[model samples]
Target: NLQLLTELDFAMAKGKLSLDMKAAAPALNSEGRIVLHQARHPLIKKEDVVPIDFELGINYHSLVITGPNTGGKTVTLKTCGLLTLMAMAGLHIPARSPSEVAFFDLVLADIGDEQSIEQSLSTFSSHMKEIIAITELAGPGSLVLLDELGAGTDPSEGAALAIAILNFLNQTGAYTVATTHYSELKGYAMNTEGVENASCEFDIESLQPTYKLLIGVPGVSHAFSIAQKLGLSQDIIADARQLISEESARFEQLITAIESSQKEIDDKKSEADKLQRELQEMRRTLEQEKEKIAKEKQELLAGAEAQAAEIVNKTRRQMEEIIESLEEKRAEQRLGHRLESELRGQISEVEKELSAHRHKRSTDQQPGEIEIGERYEAIDLNIEGVAKSLPDAKGQLVLEAGQISFSVAADRLRPVGKKPKAAGRRPRAGQAAGRTAASLTTERKMHATTELMLRGMRADEAIAAIDHFLDDAVLNGISPVRLIHGKGTGVLRQVTQDYLMRDSRVDSFRMGVEGEGGDGVTVAKLKL
Candidate 1:
C-alpha cells in the first residue's frame, strides 16, 4: 500500500511538473534556438523579453555573435545555453518558440570566468582545460556553449588557441556556440561555411549599445562610446579612432546608424508606459473593492454567529431548569413510595401482634368467659378462631379456626380468673398427650438460621463477597438464593476478585463469561 501511494503521488507530481514546463515556451533544436523576437535578459532580475531576432544553425555549425562592449553579446550566449539546459532538465524555459530537443546526453557550457584559486589554476589555464573537456566529450548528439572565448589570455596566443579548439570541435560534428572579442574568430566564421556570425546591437548618436541581438552582422567594440561614458576626453577618442584603419572606421560609422535607430525606438516607448500605468490603476481599484466586500462579509458572519451562540446559550439554560424540576419531582415520588411501604409494613406487624394477643387472652380465660355455646379465640397465634356451638346439637362449644372448624385445630378454651377444667373427658385409645413445652422449645431452635447483608463493593469486594458466601453456604446451608445489592459502577468486580484471591472459603469463582451473567454476575463453587 505504501508503494502504491508513492507511485500515485509521483505520477501526480510528474504530470504537474510537465504542465509547468510546457507553459514556459522555450527555443530548442526543432524550433531553432534561433529566437525570432526573443526578449529576456540573460542575467537580470525580472527579465523582460526583448523583441530581437537571431538564428543559430539553419545551415551553420557555429554562430559567433558579437557587438560593442556592454551590449548583449555575453547575455545572448547565457540566454541560449541556459534555456537549452532548462529544457533538457524538463523545466520551463522563458522563450517564445516551438522549442524541442532530442534528449541530448551532454550540455557543456563555459560561460563566465570563474577563477579556481583552490585548484591553483590560472584563469586562462582553467578555461583551456574546460574547453578541452568539452571537445573530448562532445559528439554529434551533444551541445556545447562557450562565452567570451579566448579573452583571458594574450590576444595573439589566445586567438590561435581558440581557432584550434573550434576546428577540433567542428571536425567532430558537435554543435557549438562561442562568444569572442577576437576579430580573428569573426574572420574564421566568415571563411568557414558552417560557421555564422551575429551581433548585439549598439547605438551611435548617444553612443550606447541597445543590448539587443541581431543576426547576419558581426559587431565591434564601442571603444570610443564607452571611453566617453567613462569621462575620457574627446582628443583621446579621436586619437584612438585615427589609430584604427580606414575599414575599421567605416564599420564604426555603420554602428553609429544602429545607435541612432535605438534612440528612435526609445522615443516610441511612451505608449507602452501609458498602457502599463492604466493597468496598474485598474488593478488597485479592483483590489480595494474586493477588500471592502471581504471585510463586510466577515463582520456579517460574526454577527450571525454571535446571535446563534446566544440562542444556544439560552436554550441550554432552559434545559437545565427543566432537568432540575424533573429531578426534584422524581425525588419526591421516590420518597413518597418509601414512606408508604414503611407505613404498610408497620401496620401489618402491629395487626399480627394484636391478633396473637387476643388469641392468648381467650385461651387463658376462666370458664365463665368461655362457657358452652360461647365464642373464643385459639391459644396458637397462627390459629385464629371463634366458638360456634357444641357437638350433637347439645349447645356444646364448637371451635372455628381459619378455613377449618377446629375443635381439633384450635386450642382449648379457658375461663377467666378460674382454674382450668381438665377432668371433663378422658383421652381415646392411641391418642398421645398434648405437645410438651420442651418439644416446642426444641422446634423453635430447629428453625433458627443465618442471614447476610452487603453493600457498596468494588470488583475485589465482590469476589470477597462470593468467597464469604461460599463460607456461609457451607456453614448455614443457604443455597439457590440471590444477592440484593443494586447494579452500580463495576468497581465491584475488580474489588471482588482482589479479595477472593487466597481466600480460604473459596473453591473456584469466575465472572460469568456469558449468559451466566456477563460482567454483572459471578458464580462460585464451594467445598461444601
Candidate 2:
C-alpha cells in the first residue's frame, strides 16, 4: 500500500510539473530514434528559457551541437537526456506535440564540471575515463551525452581523441550528442554520414544568444568579433586573423556566412507570416460584412412587399363601404337600380386608382410614449433593458442595462410583459450570482497569508515557525512575505536571514526599509 501511494504521489507531481512547463507525453518508439519539437528545460525560468527543435536516429544516430559559450549547448544536452529519462520512467516531458523518445536500455552522461580532486585527475582525464567506461557498457539501443568531449587537453590531441570516441560510439549503434568548440570536430560531423551538425543560433546585430537550435549547420566561434567589440585594436584583430592558417580561416568565414544567411531567411519568413495573418483577418472581416449587408437588404425588400399587399386590401375595403352607402341612398330617393349600378361602377374605378397609388412604407413609430422603469426588449439588438427616460425629439428611447445607458430608436423597442415594480429592487451582483455565506467563508480561508509575526520566540522556535510559514506561502504561491521579528538585539532577524540563505526555496530576501518596520522586519520572495 505504501509503495502504491508513493507511485501515485510521483505520478501526480509529474503531472503538475508537466502542466506548469507546458509539456506533453512523448510517443515511445521501438526504433532507436528520438525527436523533440519546441522542447524547453523545466528548470530554467519561463522568460529566460528558449525552445529548440531537434531530432536524432533518423538519418543520423549521433548529433554534434557546436556553439559559443553560454549559447545553450550544455543546457540543450541536459534537456534532451533528462526528458528521455523522464519519458522512460513513465513521466511526461516538456516538449510540444509530435515529440517522441526511444526506450534506451541504458543512458550515460558526463556533463558539467567533472574535475576530481580526490582522484587527482584533470578535467580531460576525468572525461576520458568516463567515456571509456561508457564505450564498454553502452551498446545498441543506448543513449549518451558528452560535454566538451575533448576539452582541457592539447587541442590537436583532444580533437583526435574526440573523433575516435565518437566513431566508436557510432559503431556500437547508440545515439550520441556532444558539444565542442573544436573546428576539427565540426568538419568531422559534416563529412561523417549519420552524424549531423547542429548549432545554437546567435544574433550578430544584438550580440546576444538567441538560444535557437539549427540542425545541419556548423557554428562559428565569434572570438574575434567579441574581441573587436570589447575595444580590441583593429590592427591587433587583423594581425590575429592573418596568423591563422588559410584553411581554418576559410572554414570559419564559411560558417559565419551560413549563420548570416540563415538569420536573413528566418527574418523574411517571419515577416511573410505576419502579413499573411493580417490579410486573412481582413478577408474574414469583409466576408462577414458582405453577409450582414445581404441579409439586411433581403429583409427590407420582404417588409416592403408585405406593406404593399396590406395597402391593396385596405383599398378594397373602402370601396365596398362606398358602394353600400350609395345603394341605401338610391333606395331612399326611389331612383332606378341602373343608377345604383352606375354608381357601383364609378366606385370600382376609384378603387382601382387607390390600389394603383404608390404605397410609402414608413419605418417610423407613431408617437410612442415611453415610461420610466418600464422593461423593454429590442428585437434588432437581442437585449432586454429598462426604460430610463421618455423618447427624445429623434424618437429615441433611453434604456438602462445595469450601469450602462444608451439611446436606441423608439421603433426598435417594445414593452416586454408588465412593468416591474420599482419597490422590488434588483439583488446585489454577488447575491444574484448565487453566492452564499459558506462560499464567502471559503474564499476568506483560501486567501493567501501575506504576513507572519514571530515576536519573543526563541531562535529555534522562530525558525520552525517561519519555516512552516514559508512552506504555506510557497503552496499558496505568494511572494514578498513579511516576517516581523521585533528589534531589540536583532537575534531573531539574524537567525531568520541565515535560515533564508541556506533555504533553496527562497529566491531572495532583504531587510525592510524605514517605512516598512526597518531592520526589524524581513521580506523574502519564495520560489514555488
RMSD of each: 19.6, 44.7
Cα-based TM-score, every candidate: 0.44, 0.52
Clashing pairs in 2: none
The digit string of per-residue lDDT tens for model 2 on 1-528 reads 999999899879988888888779999997878899878887888777888887998999999999999898998999899889989988888888899999999999988777889989888888888888999998788899999989999999999999999999999888899999988999999999989998989876667889988888899878899888788999999999999999999889999888888878867977997899899999999999999999999999989988988998899889889988965863453344336435544544543333233111123323256778888865434357899888788888788866667778777675676322347787665333322332332233355588889898987678667766775576457898999998888888887898789777799999999998998899998887
Residue 47 lDDT in model 2? 76
User: Mind giving the per-residue lDDT tens digits that candidate 1 earns over 400-490?
Assistant: 6545564433234442223234587765431221223223322333342332234565433444455445443554454433333333665
- Candidate 1 lDDT (Cα, 0 to 1): 0.62
State residue 123's C-alpha deviation in candidate 1, in Å: 1.4
> Which of the numbered candidates is closest to the native, going by highest TM-score?
2
Candidate 1 residue runs with Cα over 4 Å from true position? 1-22, 25-54, 100-102, 204-209, 254-528
C-alpha lDDT of candidate 2 relative to the true structure: 0.81
